[model samples]
Target chain A: MLEYQDYILTEFNIVLLSSIAILIFLIVLLIFEASKIRSKFGMEEEDIEHRLDLLRHLVGAGKAYLFIADKEGAVVDINPDIQSLMGLEPNQLYGKDLGIFTEDTPGSNVESLWQVLRDKKLPFHLQLRGAWKNGEEFMETAEIRPLLAENSIVGFVVSRIGSTDGEGQSAEGSEELEKAYAKEQVIVESIGDGVIVTDAVADIVMMNKAAREILDTQESEIGKSIYEILQLEDENSAMLLPQYHPLAEALEDERRVMSRSYYIVRNDFTRISLAVTASPVIVDDGIVGGVIVFRDITKEKDIDRAKTEFVSLASHQLRTPLTTISWYTELLSGAGSDNLTDEQRNYLDVIYDGNQRMIGLVNALLNVSRLELGTFIIEPEPTKVQDLIMSVLRDVQPSVEEKQHEIAFNSEEEMPEINLDPRLMRMIIQNLLTNAIKYTPDKGKITIDLSRHYPDLILKVSDNGFGIPINQQDRIFTKLFRADNVLSKNTEGTGLGLYIVKSVLDRAGGNIWFESEEGKGTTFYVTIPLEGMKAKSGTKTLS
Target chain B: MMPKILVVEDMEAIRQAITAALAKAGYNVLQAKDGAEGLEIAFLEHPELILVDIIMPEVDGIEMVKRLRDDDWGKTASVMMLTNVEDSDKIVAVQKYHVYDYLVKSNWELDDVVEHIKNKLKAATEENS
Candidate 1:
């Protein structure tokens, strides 16, 4: 019982000691909590004060304008940048409503931006009113952001946004644009030639008075398709292929189509020939429309036709009288008398041949005039090239025998009955063969080759005599253009032979070219297609 | 019997020349100053062969032939066109009358033309026979 009393006393003493220690610890904790409250409420702690100063300094150092709005929408904090930008002291702006930045409008863009952030609380575009450092009012862009605490709005933060597009469109710029537009309108209205504009899809956007008169269109044609408004024909009086439509082609290529000949049929069914130029109105976006300019060329074409007709009529008249003289002379010389001296016979021969040459020249001129006037009718018939070659050989034989030139003709393939104009083909053969014999030296070689080359017939006339001068080769086929070397040698040549040959070949859908070296040789290459000349043969043959 | 041929021409020289050439070739020839006289003689006297010029004073050759071809007698006779003009349209125009041949005067000598006429007449005779 005594030992139990001792143990109970000891345990009671230990419990008392523990109670005191717990009481002291509770008192110290209460003191610490009181000190923390004092520091926060009355005595500003040095570390926190320093940190706030640093933060202010950092905000001031930034290039961007900064501001803070409190929960009640009053300016709670703002850097010096904002104060300078707003032209107000901190005290003046500190308690003012955030609406001051929004021009005081209840629902201005800046206010709306700030209100939107109440839920979103993210940065967005906002335009705010502010004053310059000199107290002048100006507009600026800012990024408004909401300060949030657990999805509830606390305040707003704003920063100025910098941009490269600082110079907005100004009054002077817009005035200049207006003046340019007015000038363009005046030019479009007063120009002498026709001008028409169409959108990318070929809808007519505008047409000038000249265009209206030329196309015989009313303002009702505006917004109609260009193809729908104007009926078009090519220079050949045939409908244009879609790929060749000027506006369509210009729009597609974004390029200019210049001075193309076409005819527009007016409302009265009268056709007006015109030279048209079209350009795409390309902008920063892309090709928007096309501008077409045109001039009437019908009068010019009539003048040209009249000139060709005059030439044709004059040639025919000259030939009729020459023909009478020629036949009468031939009759007097050939059958009436043979008892003349050698000199007299020679004189008669000169007269006869000179008259023949004059007739030949007139005939050539007539052919050229007919071709140029587009009145040369093509009468295609079944033709044997071999027979034609043989006959031409007979006609040119006297010259060949006089020159004594060695000649060889090779037909690599049996020619079928090819469709061709026998008269024109005869001219081709005579011209080429006559040129061959005339230019060749005595005992020189001449080779004629005609062969079928799958859709074409190839004829090569090569001579091993006086070739065309190298420099003048390009001009060899020009009318009356005799080469320098041949010009000095031969005075009898009229130089229309090759020109006629080239024009006829071009019209007949054939090709002709020559390879010549001065003092060496000349080989002419000619290829005529077996077909397709019939369809391509339009009035373009004259052109 | 010698074949009688009618010649129509505007130029006296060409007309007399053709007549002389034909007479030398042993054909009886009748002459007309223009296409009107040619048409009259063509109907009044039935010549075996008729040689006509293209351009004349009162009636051109094309109009004369186009008119004479409407008659039954003018339709059957072997008519040959002898012309100095070489226009292809006029040549094709004269071809519509079913003439025996169309000849360009300058492109042939008188001797060659005589032979050509003889051959065309012979061909026409064979076709008729």
Candidate 2:
């Protein structure tokens, strides 16, 4: 029986050896098949490393932070930028749930990402705050997208910082942005001055509200040439243009340019005097566009013309009377009165004196009119100040003597020759002296002081007579304004003498002011620049 | 003998001064206060020349000149318009009346008035001759 048992054992050992060898061979075959399948379908270690390197470089260059989540909403992979963005190490985030990376409730972005993948819709953007491992937070504009496999959703999220994607946020932010853009457009359109913008090729790019009003058109002028838009008036008709258009010239020079008196007619048939300034708009080292600003000055031009006409008329009309007065007075003092008695002769003398006074008054009125019209042409030349003063003294001598007044003329030193218009200078001095004599009481004393106040010629005319009231001093230089004191003292004055004096001084680049107290005295000081200055032609009348 | 002259002006001072100057010049002067009175005198005496002021209360000088122009009896009597307002419109209005001459009051000397009247009378005599 023992021998039979041993034989069974030996048989069992042999069967076990055979089974073990078969199992070992099957295991080696399965290992080879698995490696072949891995080579065919799965990524090799080297290939996977290369793909990860590419992804790192892509995330570094792109403005996006990339991440991957598993089906369980757990973070499986992340780029280097994700670490910097969320302040987390890759190891710390790898096994952690993606909900921990966001301050929002868990599974929100994940659920949306899965929903998009399941629905197979277009990608959508979301704004959320991302939390760092250290508990710091930052705003992220995230585009959560689903990775699809055989039409089933995987997990992926792309986030960028501080991007304006025009997406989900409070309505106020979007509305405010839209309003800012619209307001910019309105401001560009509502300005009164004409604004024209052109591209580098001198093609009209943009035109503002006033530009279209000036150009008299409603159609969009973009892409048209500037010369087509700006139709300049005829050159012979007080309008001019260069060989090239203003915008084209500005573009060529790459600088600002101006055009003088470029007339443009509006749709209402009114002509406008357009002064145009064109400037180049440069960007990125090249000319991108140009802009032109235009202003209308037609009213100013009309006023100028009217002023010239008024001056000529006033000068001729006033001069005619002056000529008559002069000729008749000379005739009366000569042989015409030879047969008259002493009383008759004396009467003639009074008439002659009256005529002379009328001439003086008329002359003063003419000066005031001319000065107000800005047509008083000041032809400045080298003149002796003393000579002008003497002439003024001679002119006012009759009035001075009629009041039985004495005038004291004083000059500390010989005044240097100054440049001034002789006629205008005479008018200024005479008006000042006349004001002094007219406002002074009978037998009053007048003093004329002339001195050099460095770079200026100063003249002071003072009178020991009724002075201007303090309250009315501010308006003494105004046209046709006479102080109450002067009016009470003398009612015949036209009250235009000091106005004429002020205007003449202003034209000569000089200034005049006075100091006075009632019942004391009045003193007027005039300071004039020692230079040749021409009077501006054509002033506007203000009522 | 000096030719007869008439002075017409609205202002008393201006008229008196002109009449005195004309009398001193040795002329037989007929004085009137306004254009209507001057026209009446012109028809009655048929003065050699008449000086009239333009701006007056009754029958302004321009109208007086027009009436005198229409009168056949005073056709030879010369008429002149004198005024202080020298606007172009007024000058044009006076020109329409065929007035012999217009003078601004501030511009006319007594001698100028006398000389102008003398020239007009001398021309009339020359035309008759």
Candidate 3:
């Protein structure tokens, strides 16, 4: 068994020796595979080297001065172009502070270029401004950006652009741009209307001669705040201003106010009425400023006033004779002991009614004149709408009874006493109620509703009358517009009631609208803003 | 005695109509053509109620009232303005003189004018009593 064990051991040793040799061979092959893979990686390094060479050639050849700085702002590398631009070699700038180039800038602090990179945060990645060296002015535009890694700034690169353009040198495109700019400047200066340009902070930057004369300002207005030049009109002041008063809205919201009339109380004590427009000057950067244009409209205003005065005078002169005719007709009705034929009585009634219609037309014209002339400045007194409506109803009750109209007045919630011109409120209700009485068929239903429309007092008058023709609806508030359907139905209408109502409401800063369908019914809505009334205190009428 | 109401108007027809209406309505009525004559009639008649016009020839109603308000008879008299002139200053001035009421002549019917006077006179009587 021992000799057999020895032979088995020798065979086992031979097998083990072959296994060791195989392991050694595997080790050498593994080393060979590793070096082969390493050599392939070495080829990739040369590919990176080729890219670096291209970058070096591009940076060296380009006229733009390109430089990179380390985290400490010390120059790591700079292109050869700096030698020609700054008259300094790249070797001299190496290991130097970034502020060395800015030392020649008078009054500029020699500090970290990091300070400049942070201070002049160029919103569009580039900045252009005038730079001087040896008293020669050159337009210097540079782009600087931080090299960011993992959300934190690691390094920075600065590139000075406009490589070929020097002082007194211009490209063909730039020459054309300058020429266009000059033409535009001339056009702005020669504009007929007043033109005033303001910066973003509302400082006056430029004003043409027309603007200076119209605004009663001098060329010294430049650098002054706009509000200092023109004061805002007070809301309660009875100033004749267009709906859009001042340029405040234009500047704040970017709304273009075109041909809006406003008053400018000049230093010379003359109130100049100007129609003005304001538009914002927006560039690629943002809204940088605003441009305002204005023109004097004093002549137009005077002509409008003259027209109103003539209408007022004509109406008053006509009303006197009409009053006499009205009284004579009332007396000549053959009432007491003077019996008349039905024919005579009918003729007298016709004369009286015709005179009354003429009187109504005259009164409406006078009211419109008053509204236009600002004579109807509100003399607000605490008035209960219910009481006013009831009084108006009583005044029109005779007509209502004659027509046999069924009127319903509803006010569920009692409203507080509203501050309003009692006369104006009375006229509004009277016109609406009288029209309802006149237009509706006998025994037709008329409804009135008074309620709070929240921060407003709303009165809605509805009548089951011959509704206005839909085609003529838009012209219902014209000075002498009458709907054809209404004109045919009721020949007595002056067509001035709604116009007078509209003018009165507009002067009071209220709104009037209506909804009507032909042959169905008509509902007129009136809304009075309660904001001014609630806050008003003293009477500021033209005394 | 019945209340003596005076009608002071510049328009002749308006004056006569108002006077006739007031007389028919059972008030003793005195008539005047202008503010000058109205003041004279008001002083002599010492009417309990006076209806005055605003714009007149010799003395305007506002000026006449300003003069009459100093005297005792005019101080106690209940005056109402019946006029075509709708001057806010005149209206406010009349109120300042403690006028009873202001009626726009063109805006009122004859019956409404009479009714308003009767009601106001009745209220004045009630208050005085």
Which of the two candidates, 1 or 2, achieves a greater TM-score against the reference?
1
Candidate 1 residue-pair clash tally = 0
By DockQ, the candidates rank as 1, 3, 2
Candidate with maximal DockQ: 1
- Model 3 interface CAPRI class: incorrect
State the lDDT of candidate 1 residue by residue for A1-543, as single tens digits: 656544533432344334334434544554555557556676446534433433342244332335667667788667553454346788987888977776533445555656666755666766677665554555556666655555676556665544323132333465677789989988997899998898878888888888888877666478888887765797568887666788788988888997546898888889888888889999996887888889899999889888878877787677667767777776667665677777877887898888888878877777777777666666577888888888989888888888898889999665787888777777888888888788877888999999988899888999987899888888988988888887777777788899988988887788899999888989998887876244233221121
Provide per-model DockQ scores.
0.24, 0.05, 0.19
In Å, residue A508's CA in model 2 sits off its true spot by: 2.4
Please give, for residues A1-543, the per-residue lDDT of candidate 3 as tens digits: 656544533432344334334434544554455455448666465444433443343344332325666556578766543334345656877887655543334543335444665554321133323222233333344555554444455455655533233222224455777789989878988999988888866778887878777767666488887767655344244543332434555667777867544667767877767777888777884778888788878789899999998988887668657867776576577236168778988888888888777878777777778766666667678889899999988888888888888899998575888888877788888888887777788889999999887888899999998888888899999988888887777887777788878876776778899999887789999998765332222322221
RMSD of each: 20.5, 21.9, 17.2
Better of 2 and 3 by TM-score: 3
- Give the fraction of reference interface contacts each candidate recovers: 0.25, 0.03, 0.14
Top model number, lDDT: 1
Tell me how many residue pairs clash in candidate 3: 1
Tens digits of per-residue lDDT, candidate 1, B21-96, equal: 7888899999998989999999998898888888889898888888888898888777888886766667667777
What DockQ does candidate 3 have relative to the true complex?
0.19
Residues B7-95, model 3: lDDT tens digits: 88888878888787788788999988888898899999898888988878889899888888988878877888887766566678888
